[model samples]
Target chain A: MVPDDDTQTADERWLCAVLQRQGLEVEPARLAELARAQALLARYTEFLRQASPVSVRHLGQPHDA
Target chain B: MMPEADGDTPGLAQAARALRAGSLSSLELTRHCLARIAELDPGLNAFVTLTEERALAAARQADEELRAGHRRGPLHGIPLGLKDVIDLAGVPTSGQSSQLHGHVPMRNAAAVDRLEQAGAVLMGKLTTHEFAFGPPRWGPPGPPARNPWHAAHFAGGSSSGAAVAVASGMLLGALGSDSAGSVRSPAALCGVAGFKPTRARIDLRGSLPLAPSLDCLGPLARSVEDCALLYRALAQPGEDFWRADELPWGEIRGLKIGVVRSFLDERSGTSAPTRTAIGDAIATFEALGCEVRDVSLPAPWEWNAAGMVILLGEAFAYHEHWLRSRPQHYGAGLRDALLLGATLSAADYCRAQEHRQALSSNLDALLEDVDLLLCPIQASAAPPLDQLTTWGFLEKPSYGIAFNLSDNPALSVCCGFGPQGLPLALQLVGRRNDEITPLRAGHAYEQACEWHRRRPPL
Candidate 1:
């Protein structure tokens, strides 16, 4: 379910700003869809940050291994 | 003479024998495939291009070469379809998107070049999700490929058409790109065999990029032996390539198999039939004289989280330009998926990468004790096509993600049927660059079962 504008979370707000700054348009009808994506991204990214915080060197490798 | 239209289509192995025995001609086989496509593709939407004249010309050439006793290899004169995401010279590699409606490459993808060099007949291009990013959307290029087992169900993507074509007898085998389970999911759902080789084992030149970090080209076919044949032909030249022939066929005894049942849970919505199917497959492996034991991996949600972050980040890198300039051309599902990538921070992507490296290490440690890892490719049988949503994968952990994250060779083969009669699949994962073990294991299982012999009612 899409949160109304007044109920937008910080990530949703950030996502809106990112798209606007990049000059990318999200159709009004798709706001609910985009909000759902934002919620998923937030859930997963938080899990990554908290799960086994491995120190990674950002070497320019194409893939994980 | 052509095989009966409604009868079982000969697999590549059978076709090769018939061709060599002078009992079946390449033209006859190609014509039969073309006829099958003409009859069934209307409902399946499996092909984006037919290439009838070109396929016929190539079949005749293969016949002439064979008559002169100059066989190229096992694939010579066999019919194969390419997922449209992989380029075929002068033919539009649409990737099922309007943005590339008129774009045609002048060179075949490196794998395509290799297949042709082996004298394989090019049947045409198969369907894929738009840019291979998300669920198929209703759009200009064509309807999504429907499951051969039941048209109302999902075929699984983004390699939907490749699996559907092979399962329905429209093509004996086909090439597909796997990034985040694209090839295996469809193959599992369509009740065929799909193999995703270790990353970088096959040259990626000339194929459209999804997440280059995760993208690998693989084959979908009716049986494990057919997948092995195609993999041998597509893999880059190396010691690994030659070692493929050394696979001890029917000798999987004494092999150690690790079962990862934690990959599914109530949250993943695994069906009872799927669980039973996998349980039965484990028993079959044990009866074949293999040692089976339960093992654990990092939680599926943890691996799933890291995979999605990296996949979205890398995919957005490839698609940012198109997503920005021609946003109108993309289907809403693809657009939404690509946009999600924009919302990710560099920190998030880096963390995901860290998780990937750590997970790879964990998997490597696990593999040191086992010959192969086993799991279910899907939690259940193919769901109704209408039930699929672009964001649904995020909620359910995927069985195919950990292999992609670790770059291991993973093969999905049919194990049994579900209560709904759709196919239930089991995945066999081998150590990186060691696809031979999984292929051998899958081949043994296929030989012991009747699942692959059953045809879809379509």
Candidate 2:
């Protein structure tokens, strides 16, 4: 659950907006947990972005479409 | 009809031999499994559905065929289970989710068709994490499969029931789908042998997909030979498919084995027992005439990051519609996981794919030098169920996911027991499209060690 004060993270605030934009209404009880999951993915994606440009051969794979 | 085989549950190969010898009938074997399931499943929760009548009928037909000199193959008369995500015609393939509770597929999965063609009796649908994404938890239709090693501990996810059933002697062999370590993880924790063949080696049709690029179907069994037998039946023929005679078996001497020591580093959170078990495994390989050396790959967390991004993104793409239409239908753990995918962009997913190619290339290059890469499958023994969290992987790098990212054939075999008496496993990875090396190495390792001989206290 989201804390009442002082502990709300930027990830929590950003995720709230992202969910709202996607029309996903997360229960207040789960907002903090979802925010944590979002943050983890964000960290992972950020790590991947800094790695390298995607090769053309990879983009041609079946699921890449 | 022959009397039921007394003593412990026979491995798939042993059962096949007994059946062909006329000392054990398929009906007797099926009844043995049925009786065990009836007596044990209430506590293990390994099976979500039981097709006792169908199994009996199939077993009888197998017996008639054997008696008529129509032996199909090694799988003939063997009883096996399918992870709930794999379809068995006319049976509900729940994928262990509330949404798919009544969802029964009209046709058998390709693997199921092959198993049936090989004369294997289908015991029933085994439990799986919800849609193969949720953590091990009790929700929706039923509780998660309890680890046979320690009832209070988890049986590992996604393929939870497959490993539990195999470990508990409820099934001789079972098929479990893996995308990012599902099969190996469960098999490790449950102390069974599991083989994840190269990507798409087995036809994915009729099995639910967790990630199209990463998805693989594999076998879990009491021994590597049993796993190999099941693999031979399920895997589609390809340019690189292994012929029955091609398996190294006792010919694994002089093989080059690479130990990924970096995976055992403190950063990976590898427990001391797991590390010592892996060290002993290395020593055993050396004693068996394998040329072992230390090797390193890109950080495990790096591969894990790439794998997880692709997994979460692809899974979200598949579940988005249902998630939007009826979020309540999902377990909170899986629902939360799928929602994390929404945070990723197409760029993120594609970039991970690109990173995947680089990681695969690195592994391929390393395999050119080493015949097999040995590592720890799990960082530690199975944790108590109450200690598990949905996003626990975020905190610890999964040792098995790197192989999934690289599309390698990886085998998980029980190596030793931890201090808690729970099983610890070591992983052996082979080159892409080459499952024989890992299976051969695993089989040889089993012959050299007595770990696989120990059964769960259950």
Candidate 3:
């Protein structure tokens, strides 16, 4: 879970900036929500970073349509 | 001999036998199903649309064809429902979403086409989770289907109604699309048979896309034999169809079975009743002369996360346009869930894809010496509706998604009942395209035990 502190707020703002750059609308009604989701998804990427160590990467997989 | 349809509801295979023997006409079977739906659907909430007129017309045509010595195979004259996501030419495939309320397809989905070709009587569209992504958020279109075993409990989603309809005898068979445990979860919760064949075994054109890459259309019925019959009817043109009767049932003794014990370890907080049921099943298999061996599997969390990323990314890609144009049209649950995918980077999806391939290969390596892998589909019985949390699906680790990622054929068959009398199911997985092994094992186990014979108290 993302911590509740000053850093978290700053992180949310930074995440919001990246999302806006990614072409998202980031409307006021959904701004805070989308920012939190961005943080969570970033964590998913982080999971991949950790998983990469234990997981095999690209074992000659034939691309599935 | 004419089957005396006293009060008991015969399964699909038996009903088809009666229809072929001239003891039961399609019209009679259709009427019985319609009556049951009328009497029970008010409490069960199993359908989005009921095609009474068309079903009767189709049944009449089926009877005419059968009387003229024309048989379309096992599903002929059998009344069945399709998960609302399945397209049926002129019928609206609402998918329990208010957004698609007016959407109707011009052609039947490939799976639907196959069922029709086999002379199936299309009863109607059954309820599904909104967009096949979230649990029921009821309103506008219809109410979510409830478990017939205990009305207060949830019949699983996103294929909720398909399981409920079959459990309640409203339909002999159903077509449910499983992207991540949707079909199997519902079948286990409702105490019926659900088969998720190899990913490419059935085509999905015209079906509403949830996660295109992972989507599989499968059958949910009462017996493994019945599920196999439905699969035979819907099997892809050249895909290997596993016919249950053709396999040597006793060969199960020679095959090796692997049990994934870590999947239900205490750290996962699996329920006792479910664990006990699977334990009994493992012992039963051993007693029946099969060699059981313990197998180590990847952490459930890893497999669960792997499935979710692929699911979320693909789902967002499919619904991105609508989500942007008419966000309010989506139910609250799906709207938020789709938003998470909006932030997924291209690298993230690619990474998940890499993991997907890796995981499949790892599981394949483990199963190289084993004939089948057996595990529990659900860790507990169906909980009450109020007991479900909004984000529960995201938080929990799934037992069914690993095979989905591997593209292996997995089946959910009833193993036993919990103390509350709700059903628990055993998941049988087989090598890709080698679905016959699991079906034969399921048939043998089902024949030996009385689990599949039991039905919901409703």
Candidate 4:
């Protein structure tokens, strides 16, 4: 599933702004970094959405052993 | 003076003295420590892997170097433990996750290399929470590391084993990372001195990430001076930030201390004993010539919410691949807790980042007039091991994370004992990259107060 376009764009802009403020000479390179970070975040968000309803106890323990 | 028979009274100063005077060889010290671990660790579960063979070999090398007049300074020949997340070459740098159980690194983390170069013997890999994000839960591939003060109580995570090992004398000191109170919380509960140096003071290379922006590697020891010794070694040599030599201790006569009473004094469900102990510590600080004034925090919830959003976003980025490929390998609490990060929209994360910038600005302004800020490390002492809930993180006012957001140095110094007789501590926060001032103040206070002289009856 694709992340909401508006939210991703906003995140990218915010990250670029932060980098610029930190005086890191942000430009297109900073935008690329933001894009990569956001993509990773988006992927994980989706993974959470698809995860089964597993209890905290059942996550690590053997069930049918 | 003779060394204090009570382990608590003999701080790191005594240990260093013993090493320097040839009263204790590093090899003998290592054997004594291994024996302690074999005896007490069965009850405490402080180590995930005890490197007995490596420890002995390193100890032998340390002894040879000392005899050859090749001293490495105060931490020379000292034995220390690395939290499982800090990679030591050839050891499994498990994030305590089953998914990464067999994961080993080809090189030591920067901090570990620094410690080794300082002549510190690596005792073993200590336990941590799954990815350094969750509490210790029972029924694991291993037992939960328990508090040394009370075997049944929790050793706060995700630096759980590191704190326990240091407090129990199984190791002289240990390395721990702090993202959101992971270092100080456990150090506070376990009656040890834990330092969270200013962000980036020590290199994070080869260390596992909880939040890349916030994680800091520091030492957990029995005294502030020991923490300072380890900090000086781990920090990049010649870096201006690790300037402990310039700090003048016992000169706190004109220091301005911000009490930070709003969040600290707020009725955040802290136990009465903890409240009383903190009250006494403030009075003690006042008596020691510090100018104490109440300071306001940037609305407690705002700081926490901002930290939570950023932390989750960052942590999820690291765990995403594994969460997809092997969802069942993570522990229950950690999986659910990390899942919350998954639900954070990009907008939410950005808003959190914006809030973080504002909070950092506000906190810096608040500290402009004060040399240091003081608060309770945790709201209370160690809770029972079995009583901690899945959502325990949401329930407390995290005094440690506020500094993490500001990228400042924060230390946990054991102040006194709570009602249950477990250790109670106060958080000392300094300006960005200014660890010297806090270390000096903490060292001076430790000298004046008898608190650091007391040890848990293990």
Give the candidate number with the greatest DockQ. Answer: 1
For residues B1-458, what per-residue lDDT tens digits would candidate 3 score against the true structure? 32234565689989888888898999988988998899999999999999999999999999999999998887899899999999998999998888996998899999999999999999999999998887677677888899999999999988999999999889999999999888999999999999999988888887888988889999999999898888877887444544422433455776799998778676665688888888899988988789999888887778877788888999989888877677778887777778678767777787788888888998898789898999888878999998887666556778888888998999999999988889999899999987778888998889888798886887
Better of 1 and 4 by DockQ: 1
Ranking by lDDT: 1, 2, 3, 4
lDDT of 1 at B123: 91
Better of 2 and 4 by lDDT: 2
How do the residues B85-126 of candidate 2 rate in per-residue lDDT, one tens digit apiece? 999999998888888867989999988999999999999999
Over 4 Å off, model 1: A1-12, A52-65, B4-6, B242-248, B264-268
Docking class of 2: medium
Can you write out model 1's per-residue Cα lDDT over B124-239, one digit (the tens) per residue? 99989999876787778988999999999999999999999999999999999998899999999999999999998889999999888889999999999889888988988767
lDDT over C-alpha atoms for residue B233 of model 1: 87
Per-model TM against the reference: 0.95, 0.94, 0.92, 0.85
Off by over 4 Å in 4: A1-65, B1-10, B238-248
Cα displacement (angstroms), candidate 2, residue B305, comes to 0.8
Query: Candidate 2 — which residues are off by over 4 angstroms?
Result: A1-9, A53-65, B1-6, B238-248
Better model by lDDT: candidate 1 vs candidate 3: 1
Model 1 residue A45 lDDT score:
91
True contacts kept of each: 0.77, 0.70, 0.23, 0.00
> How close to the true structure is residue B444 of candidate 4, measured as C-alpha lDDT?
79
Query: Which is the better candidate, 1 or 3, if ranked by TM-score?
Result: 1
DockQ for all models = 0.59, 0.58, 0.29, 0.02
Compose the digit string of candidate 2's lDDT tens values, residues A1-65.
23344566777777767766776756777888888777777789888877755545466556533
